[model samples]
Target: MIERKITYQHSFIGQQFIAKLDFTSQYHSLYCARLKSLKYRCISADESGYFSLSEIMEVKVNQSCLIAGIIVCTYADRSSIVEKYISKIGILADRKQSTFYNRRKEEDFIYLEDESGRVRLDLKQYFDWENLITGLVVAVRGVMRENSVLEVIEIFYPSADPPRPLLRKGDEFICFISGIEIGNPSLDPILLNLLSNFLQGNLGNDSAEVAKNIVRFVILGNSLYKADKENSFEQKAYSDISADIVPSISKSLEFFDTFLAELAGILPVDLIPGEMDPSNSSMPQQPLNPYLFPLASRYSALRSFPNPYECKIDGIHILCTSGQNINAIMQFIDTQDPIKILELTMKWRHLAPNAPDALGCIPMQDDDPFIVEDLPNLYVVGGMPNYQKLVTEEGVHCITIPKFTSRQQVVLVNRFTMESETLSFVSVIQGMNNC
Candidate 1:
C-alpha cells in the first residue's frame, strides 16, 4: 500500500461552537446576527429597480418598496415553547402536531422582519412559496398594500460565494459512511465487519486497490445505537437506572471503539456526532469526547469534530454535517428532496437557517457561526434516506450519504475531479453444488 501525501487541516479554531452561551438572550440575537451578515449579499442580488430598499417602518401604503430581512413563518398549528411546557406538566392538553404546516394553508402567514419592525407579507403572488422557510435572509421587492401588508413581487436570495480553487496535485478519495448504527440489535454484524475489512484492504485485490486511494474515512454519525427503552420507573430513579443502563452503554462503547480502531489504525478517521450520538443536542454539535473511545483515542489517526464539521483537504474546503439540519428543515417544508434543501442553504449563505426555530442551536449573541462565509468544494450531509449527489453551478459538490445500516452503501469521491460514486456491499450466496 502506498502512503498518502495529501495535506489535511481541520478548520475549527478553538471552541467556536462549544462555548459559554447566552442563555438569557432569546433566539432574537441569532436572527439579528444572521440578517446583519447576509443583508449586504441580499441587497447585491436584487437586480430589479422597481423600488429602492427601505426599512419596514418606512414603507408607505400603495407605494413600491424593497426591504431585506429574515423570513418569519407563522403556522396555525405551531406551538410556542410555553404552550409545550405547560402541556407537558398536565396543565393543558398537548396541542403539538406532527407537522408544523396548517391544514388550511391560507392561515399560515409569512412575514419579513428586521431590527426596525416586522411587516406581514402577502406571498400569494409569489411563485416559489415552497422554497421559502423561516430564518432565511432574503430581499423582497413589493408594494405596501392598504391593509399594511407587503405584496411581494420578487424575492432575492444571496449569491453563493465562489468555490475555492483546488490547490493540490494528486488524486485521493474521501469515504463517507453514515448511520453505521452500531449496537442496534437488528443490525447485521457481518456488514460492519465487511466494511472494516474492505477499508483495511483485506476484502480482495479490487477492493484493496480502491481502499488504498481512500485517504480518509469519515463516520457520519449514529455510530452507536441502543434499542433499550427506559421505563417510567427508571426515568424517575437515577441510581437504579444507571445500574441497568451503564452495562449497555459500556458494551456499545467497546464495540464502537474496536470498529473505529480497526479503521483508524490503517488510515485517518473523523468521528462526527449526530442527533443520536453521545454529544450536545444542538446545531454545530460539539465533537465526541475522546474519552468515549478509549482504544481509538490512542491512535493519532483518529479525530473528532463538530456536527457541521468544516475543513480543508488538499486545499479544497469541505463542509459536512450528520443531517440534523436537513432533517429539521424537512418537517416544515413541502419537499422531501434533501439536495434541494441543501442548495437552498447554499444560496442563502447559511447552513442551518432554521436553527433556534425548528432546530436546536447554542445561542450566540454576536456571531452566527452557521453562516457560510466561504463556499466549499464539497458539501456532505449524512444519514439521509438514500445516497444522492449534486454539483451546483457555483462548483459546489453537494452529497447526501445514506445510512449504511439501511442501504449498505458508502460514498467515494475523487478529491480532484469532484466526481462521486456509491459503493455497496452484499453477502455472497452459496450454491447447492453438492446436491
Candidate 2:
C-alpha cells in the first residue's frame, strides 16, 4: 500500500487555520481541503479520498450536525485537491454512486457531497439535495462539534441577496416576493394597483358585494377566456360594467333591500319572496311589503295566473306572482300595458296526491288585477280555460308550469307557508297592516 501527504487551510469569521497530514491519498486531498475549510479540529483521510472530522469543539456524540464548504476539486477514480481558496467565488458540482454491503448489513448508506464537503444523508433528505442541485443556494446554520467523523452541528439555507423595500400597489404587492418568481413582469403594475385598492377598501363601498361582483367577473372572464382564447370582448365588457357599477352602488342596508326587491321582481317569486309590492289604492309610505300576494291553491295554478302579471297601486304597478317563467312574464309585460283579465285561476300542478285539501280560489282587489302600461294592451287570466292559449297568443307568450315529482314539493310548500306566517308575525310586531 502507498501513502500520500496532504496539506490544507481554511478561514471562518476572519480567523484562519492550517493542517497537514499523510493518508491513503486517492481523492483524500480534495476531501481534506474541504473539511479543513469547515474548521474541523481533527481530520482523517481514507483511500477513497474521503475525509472525516476526527474531532470538533462544542460537539456531543450521537447528535445530528450540518457541514458546508465549496467544492475544490473532483477528480476521476483518483483524488486531487485545489491549491487555493477564493473568498467570494465557489465552484458547484455533484456526484453519486452505489456501494455494496455484506450480508450482515441490511443496507448501505448513501453519501452526498456539496460545498460543505461530504456527509452521509438519509433518503428523506433527497429533496434538500435536489434543491442544492437545481442551483438553489442555501446557507445552513447548525451546531458544531468534534469527536465524531461528521463536523456540522446544523445546516440551513440562507438568503444570498439583500432585502429591498416592497413597492406599494393598493393592498397587494406590485412586485413578487423573494421566493416568488414571476414569468411575466408586465402585469405586475396592474396587479399591484388592484391589490392595493382592494386592501384599502377603495375598490367599492359595498366591500362584500364588490368582492362578490369581482369574483363573478373573474369567473366569467376566465370562462370566456377559455372559450375564446384570441378575443375576450364579452369578458372585457362585463368587467368594465361591473367595475363601473360596483363603485357607485351604496353599501347601506336600504340599498341591499332595494336591490333585492328589484332582483325579486325580475326573478321567480317562489325563489325569492317579497320581490313585488301588493297593490295599494294610494301611494304607500316607506317600508313596503315587497312580497304581498295570496298563496295559490296549487303550485301549478301559478302558471294560469293573470297577466300583465303586475298590478298598479297609485300608478306604481307591482308583479303579483313568483311563477317560474319570469323571463317570459317580463317579456309579456314589456310588450303590453293596461292588461285586463277576468276569471283567472292559480293552479298547483305539483300538488302531492296526499296533500291537504287545496285552498279554494281567492278574491283579488280592483287594483290587484295584473296591468302593466309599459306593455301593449295585455291581460293575465287565472282559472280561465283559455289561459294557456292566451299565453301563446301573438304578441303574448306562455310558460308551461312544471310539476314537482318528489315529496320535496310538499316540504317546500310547507316551508313557504311557514315563512308567510313568520312574515305576518314580523308585520304585527312592526305595527304594519297585514291585508
Best prediction by lDDT:
1
Scanning candidate 1 in windows of ten residues, the lowest lDDT window is 231-240
lDDT by residue (91-117, candidate 2, tens digit) is 523121121112233342323345334
lDDT by candidate, in order shown = 0.79, 0.22
- List the candidate 2 regions with Cα displacement exceeding 4 Å: 1-111, 115-118, 121-151, 166-435
Question: Which stretches of candidate 1 lie above 4 Å from their native place?
Answer: 1-15, 21-24, 90-98, 102-104, 165-171, 226-243, 428-435
Model 1 residue pairs with clashes: none
CA displacement after TM-score superposition, residue 25 of candidate 1 (Å): 3.6
Q: What are the per-residue Cα lDDT tens digits for candidate 1 across 1-435?
A: 334544655444324565563467787777788898888788888766555779999888998888999898988777777987788688988774546754366778889998899999887888887667899999998899999999998888877669987655555788999988777776788788888888877767988888889988888887876344532211122233446566776788899999888887888898998766777666777788899989999999899988788877656778888998888787687876999888777877888888888887888888898888888889999989998888877888899999988888899988877788998874421121233
